[model samples]
Target: MIPLSRNSAVFGLNIDPIGHHNGAWRHPLTQVSRAYDISYSLELSRMADAAGLDMVFIADGLSVNRYAPDSVVLGFEPLTLLSAVAVNTRNVGLVCTVSSTFTEPYNLARMMSSLDRISHGRAAWNVVTTANPNAALNFGPETLPDHDSRYERAAEFLDVATALWTGWQADAVVADKDRGMYFDPDRVAVTGHHGQFFTVEGPLNAPRSPQGKPVIVQAGASATGRDFAARYADIVYMVSQDLEDAKAYYQDIKRRARDHGRAESDILVIMSVRVLVEQHDNAAQERAAELAELVSAEATLKRVSSFIGVDLTRYALDDVLPPLPEADDIQGYRTQLALVRRLVQSGQVRTLRELATRLNGGQGVLSFTGDGRSVCDNLQLWFEEKAADGFMILPQQTQRDAENFVKFSLPVIRSKPFGRQRPEGATFRSRLFG
Candidate 1:
């Protein structure tokens, strides 16, 4: 079982091909061409593994935004890429995004189950409801479900998938050579799930996984989403701009989890943070500014439009953002939209360009730009305050940034009083909880 260690924060890296910054592919540090090759992903995951990080996450999108095509294209299917990464990196956990909305439960259960076994229990599934409305077109449904319906469907989807995973008992696979028996049939169960969104027949054809069940990861920020996460997720990914908000989210999720009769440790709240590391603070800030300058405003607006189901192109760059639709009127990612909306309405952001810059360049996630030691000190404050169980490093640029984070932050992380010796050859579950 994965044990809890309050001292150490579970670090993770979102190893995107071109980094999380929209302009990463254009930066001097990133080689956009190499990211198209599988080797690039392998290299990043290997670095994460060496750093003793808990997990490496891969985000996936079902459809391409034709309106915002200038940004770097992440071509690899998350599962396919993580599968390759699984065989290559021995210790690090692999987390991949998969929508519960459009995918079949049985198919998803089988694939994730197999991946967990292949990775020897280092697999985590990031459950999503396919927030991008454009994705509906690609899935052969021009119209998308409303926000509440989507979460409802997702709840049922998780139920079916989780049931299928446990359909076969741990001892079901007993290859008795003398009797020519493959397994004990009595130990296998058929899920026989029939629900609002889907019906899944049980006993996954695969054997029970090493971890019994792959870790469950959830990232939903709305009230319904938070409650859903509290009920099922082992990990909750969040986006926050400051410590207070982070702490609030951390406490809220933990409280919601307790309400569901689950321990606070059962849910690991991981904040999505962009870390820009350099030899000096000034240099890091300059690199971040340069990367921001490279992002296309036209593309950024369209990307935002696709996300919030609002056409932002109608407004000029320098003009104050127009009044946004009510949160209920939105069918896309409501939590982030609400965050950004409050920023504009509260006079924190004066222009559309300013908010677009933050969304496109900063990825609507929080940022920490400084030299290695200084950056670690900032993270130390958050960790000690219980703002999060861990921080997922969303690099704004490629190779060098990740290299710097490891080269610089590793020593400090090791030196911290909370540091624990990594258990060798243990399942990712053990690494997290033990």
Candidate 2:
């Protein structure tokens, strides 16, 4: 019932309808038929809200074929679904993914600003420059622009959109019911801007929301991506499995924030983690084994190949991976690319099949699998060592398993000194930054 103490680790959920595992739907308890309905999503968010997590994040992509893992498919557009969820949930933050690559700055700005207002300030945008090569065809381009080029465009896009968000001063609106004047013209002014990617004439049509604007969340692991996030992102999502790697990343981002004239605490670093929990450690391992049995070696290899931009069909699953591309040259999801390189070179996975199955859990972010107390213990270690300021919860193989997280893990967290049961601040930004 009480707020988490100052040093408690923050947490949020990235809800997966069926689940994040490729064979999640095969789980007997998951209501596969309910995965597509708006009611089901509302149920998911309500579960998080009731359990007292800080936010429920909905991830999106422009191309359906991009990352086409069979078991987990996002059912609705992030913005539209969040709009519906906004009116229903009272406490948890509503965060959605929006591509800075294909969208116009003006339109994206308007929608996000409107969502923030509609949600009464508990809104966040997971800004992305989509990496799918297939996504280019949908936008009339034959190919995705080179990685660096896309980041360049994204920098300009963010500048234009943010300017529009601040065009109206906080006190610009003065509704005088007796006189019937809706706003004061002098308080709002034109943005009057020109830029490389876009040119917007004036201020946005919508007024600022209760939180001033939507909190900026980003997930980019490349060198360029890191710099971009350092300059603007309020929260940075990472897919780091190893502790040393995670700490290095945390330090670099904090340093970059200082370079950008931001306080070290200005940027929040969130590590994505997979959770499989139960009443006892044995029950958790049995649950893990059950999910492992359903995994198909071939399907997983194909998925892994798509992520690293390599063709692995020629090699048998038992063979060692052929040399992989250096992390710097990887064109898609650099986070996954880094994981692949780590798994192979470290001899953690001696064969292709081991690597494929390893990546099956939310692209191989670290897994916290055991009883609730043990899971929280490990999470506290990550938090104390400066590996992460917080964590993004990736639900395991079923909707029931997802609920299992709230039911089992949260109570333990509430009892632990370093664990938090509820979101910290009144608004999404305040919760993250303050």
Candidate 3:
């Protein structure tokens, strides 16, 4: 049959696995005590699976404790945690972040391949070049690598990793007990990669994964980042404050993908979405207000200062965000800076204090608070504008909000004529993009 054409899709959510917002766990109704519980995370996975979500993702980093006063602390190791969730859920894709800068490609490839085996083709890798300087120090470096170098090394890292993953041919895992051999050595090839960054030898210890090589998910938004995604990513996770900008970004990515000899449909673009739900619209608004109030401006200043590597402590609250003398040189979160600029240009906020409040609560993704219909309306506008292939839903405050989306918004999304459908046990990419 001819390949089907589709305009949009249902994307996954990025659960901090701990929590997304800084003060999310502090909500009176939130299950704060269960934040570290494996069962709690599994329940989330089950909820999304029942709702037919494309996937459930968890972001990770090597270092810890460097969050805004209200920022959530991610305590669980993402890949390991996702493996646990994998056993509990039936269908939803399980995604985990693993930094290319800090990990050896071979080990990462083996672990992800094992996850695919355990999850039955429902695993993905959210490749990241972690930004926190503390993370760099933890990885045996006093100074963080420059942004250009990080991406450069990341590109080669992908090449070596993918080569290793693909080195083992499919059907090599024949458990022929009669022959006293588990597999055929003839099908295994070695990846003799000698590059500027990494030197890896031989085929991966694991067999070829079910989805070929687990889907490549990328979250970089800079020029180099976009190019990297174009070449390697099956899914792109991004943050945008407005639909128009999202549309522009979508168009650019499709263009880039084509220039790189890929079809537009070959890549999925999903935005990080913040959802605030309640029994009614008014209640949802009230919850948002409560969440906003929990953030301390002083805390915001501290977080933003550390985020930008500038201490805003001595500056007057009225002062502009310290001139980013090395703004262009800043690594890791260009998306955050762009949103800050938009808010500044729109006059929605003045002073670094106000900017901090707006940004510190959510991780600078699009924020919305309303009942299901309103939420769907906002989402539809984004999809129609070609601003997104789908969204990574992040519920604010508690699991109640996430539950509300499953009960209310998810059915509506499923009814929409977007996304792809595959056989009952298709791979994660097949379910996400068809």
Candidate 4:
């Protein structure tokens, strides 16, 4: 097994204005009007930087559905948004999702490399083979490629992207005004890549950024997904409903990394967790209950149906969740389908109503609700036990809850007893894997 570092745990802030909970926009504390405002995201990113968090992650989807009107349907494009945030924050890493299926490898390489330079080496790319079927119509295809085929394309895309990022050597630039020689052509080379998904001819136009390359991140949980991550991803985002499963996944992925001829410690597994923090335990509980009450059964069914690519509305709310089609059959999020099945098979969830409620609140993410100290304790347990290298904090209510975490939980987490210290690295990659 790969042993975790005893140093401070890595942390990332998921800057979703609507929050991770389905009912977050309905919460009184959330500023629903500013969900699309760049100022709002800048404030959050600045807060994360002040709190000494390692990164700020922005998730994006190419298509929207009418069934989940309250969901985050409209927002700034991720790369563009991250570019803005990059200018506003100094220390925090800027990670954004850009789909391999929808984007060309050459364009992606240039954008990420530019962001890396703009952020002074604080950039990471979350690689995804978009699962949304509606995305196809926008991209001139009737449907998304099959699951395995999508992964195949993503693998080749990464190969080309990485090659472009590294094609120019560090010593390639040697400005000599006396000789009028700005750079050494011999030090740079072309990728000349001709792969199944893409064909790129030469080196990228941009010079290498401070970090050598933007950190590669992946967040898929299928068999092919796992293999792809093991082979290429530097950081991985995972979804787990409980501790046992989290540990199992952590070990499994680390093992896969070893099998791929990479050190287990080379990849960091950060679990996505929703947190609700209040000054007192009772108030936090009340806050969670209030959010739960706002969950609409009809809306939940529609959202869930779209997620698994099945019409769950056909069944009654209280009906036992029927057997699902194979993961290969679903064009949407297959990992979400697997999570639902695991919950049912373990008897942790009984009916469509329960599953809907769970997904609506955390999207099947593990949730911790408590006062600041208690929340810190829960995180410490997970970090020390090796269930997670760190956590991607998804606040239930964005502004207020995020402030509470930074104010109360962060200091406690950074205290000496916890041994959590700011990473000493000058670049984002060094901070993550130094």
**TM-score against truth, every candidate:** 0.94, 0.95, 0.92, 0.95
Q: How do all the candidates rank in terms of TM-score, highest first?
A: 4, 2, 1, 3
The Cα local distance difference test for each model comes to 0.82, 0.82, 0.77, 0.84
| Candidate 1 wrongly placed segments (more than 4 Å) | 1-5, 296-299, 418-425
Judge candidate 3 at residue 197 and give its lDDT: 88
Off by over 4 Å in 2: 1-4, 66-71, 176-181, 422-424
Residues 1-434 of candidate 4: C-alpha lDDT, one tens digit per residue: 12324556789889987787888888887777778889999999999997878899998888877655677665889989999999998889998899999999999999999999999999999999998888988999998898889999999998899899999998888998998988888888889998777889878998788987899999877888988998999898889886787888899899999999999889999988888889899999998889988877767777777777778889998998888877656767987877877888788888888888767565678788889888899988887788888889998888768888888777777773443655546799988777
lDDT score at residue 157, model 1, on the 0-100 scale: 85
Candidate 3: segments with Cα more than 4 A from true spot: 1-5, 66-71, 175-181, 320-322, 325-327, 345-348, 418-425
* Model 4 error, position 287 (Å): 1.6
Clashes of each: 4, 0, 3, 0
What lDDT does model 1 reach?
A: 0.82
Question: Which candidate gets the maximum TM-score versus the true structure?
Answer: 4
Better of 2 and 4 by TM-score: 4
TM-score between model 2 and native: 0.95
lDDT of 3 by residue, 143-240 (tens): 88888888999999889888988888899988999999899988888899999988898789888878878888997677888898998999898787
Per-residue lDDT tens digits for candidate 2, residues 1-434, read 67657677778887767777666787776778777899988988888888878889988877766345473566889999999989888878888899888899889989998888888889898889888888899999999988888899989988888888887889888898998878887888788878777878878998887786788999878889999999989899988778888899999999999999999878889888888888888998987888777877777777777777888877998998888887779668776887888877777788887877777644677888888888878888999999998888877864756677788877887787667665446788877665
Better lDDT candidate (3, 4): 4
Which has the better TM-score: candidate 3, or candidate 4? 4
Clashing pairs in 3: 22-70, 22-71, 22-72
